[model samples]
Target: MKPLKRILRILKTISLYALLLIYLSPFFFVLINSFKSRREIISNPFGLPDVWSLDNFVTAFQKMDFVSAFVNSLVITFFSVIGIAVFSSMTAYIFVRTDWRFNKVMFFVMVAAMLIPFQAIMIPLVQIYGGLNLLNSRWILIYMYLGFGSSFAVFLYHGFIKAIPLELEEAAMIDGCSRIQVFFRIVFPLLKPTTLTLIILNVLWIWNDFLLPSLVLISSSNRTLPLTTFYFHGTYTSDYGLLMAALMLTILPVIIFYAFLQKYIIKGVMEGAVKA
Candidate 1:
């Protein structure tokens, strides 16, 4: 029996490692190939570069206009995230705290919106925003992100806020604290883990989003990293080496951001699960 149990455990461990390697293989391939020349990449996709040259990175950087695209992406993501966090939290708090038929209907409507695919509404979205002269604007893009992101953010905050005791807010209110103060000072502070989780998730979504940005941003100057990297793929040919390098550069920040906030994701989930 002991031998059988040990054998099962060893097999399970091996299976887990195999799955991990399979999932990580593409990233490994991309990273190694990013250092190679175009010819070397085509010939030896899995092997190391003959010389660890920065030429691909240099070409990709200039071709993509990395600095400008990076700033554009940063600004759009930062503002969109901030707007989603603040507005969603406040809206969810209202829905949870208030007793009104209209509020309940609105909350349900927002939740229903999540089920509707973006492709269904994108044409109408473009038409409406275009009529309003809102296209090709980064601020408008941020606004669109906030609108799309709010439903899920509100859902998360709604459940988490329900788990919070009302007595805390009531006590604060009794001690001369205004409703707004009670929220910002007491309620919002307790939502730190969930907030961090949402922010990280939103950051990743907004940073990598390609289709939405492409539709909204018509000018080359407003291109994000994903859009910028896409320039390497032309009609007849593609720059594989530079494309790989651009992909690495584009995803590196998101990887670092997730690494920092990953702890909060598990912590938030466990807390919410226990409390709920």
Candidate 2:
């Protein structure tokens, strides 16, 4: 019996490591290949670089216009997160606190909107933005993000708000505070966990988005990180070395940020999950 148990444990450990390597193989390939020269990469990508070169990363920075793209991504992501958090929180609070007929209907409509696919609406979105003269502007992306993101954000907030105590707000009302004052001063502060979750999710979406930004951004100068990487794939061919280096640079920040803040983000999600 003891020998059988030990054999099972050993097999489980081996299986776990196998799965880990399978998931991480792409990163390993990218890291190893990034060090190789374009010719060496093409010849034997699986092998180590004969001579390590910073040239791929150095060249990518210049050709990819990394600085401008980074700035554009930062600006778009920052505003998008803020807009999603504030608007969704406010909307959620109103709907959750009231029993109004219209508010209930509106909540269902918002949830239904989440079922609509982005591809189905992309043509109409482009047309609307064109008519509104919002083409080629970063704000257009932010606006679209807020509209698309609010449904989920509000959904999260609504559940978390129910779990929060209503007595605190009632006490503030008795102290002559209006509903607005009670919300910001009393209830909003209690929603910190949910807000953090919303911020993290919205940031991730806005930061890594490629399709909409590529379509809307008119110039290479206005490109985000993902859009900037497109130049790596030329019509005739591609520079795989520089492309991998740029890919590393683009993802490093997001990985680092999530690693540090993921604890709070996880707690927020768990705490805010609506129990049916």
lDDT (tens digit, per residue) of candidate 2 on 12-37? 99999999999988988888777777
Off by over 4 Å in 2: 264-276
Per-prediction tally of clashes: 0, 0
User: Which candidate leads the pack in TM-score?
Assistant: 2
lDDT of 2 at 93: 97
Q: What is the per-residue lDDT of model 1 for residues 186-221, given as tens digits with 9 covering 90 to 100?
A: 989898878877886777689889889989998989
Q: Quote the lDDT for 118 in model 1.
A: 86
Q: Lowest-scoring 10 consecutive residues by lDDT in candidate 2?
A: 267-276
Residue pairs that clash (backbone atoms under 3 angstroms), model 1:
none
Pairs that collide in candidate 2 are none
lDDT of 1 at 139: 89
Q: What is the C-alpha RMSD of each candidate to the true structure, in Å?
A: 2.6, 2.3
TM agreement with the true structure for every prediction: 0.89, 0.91
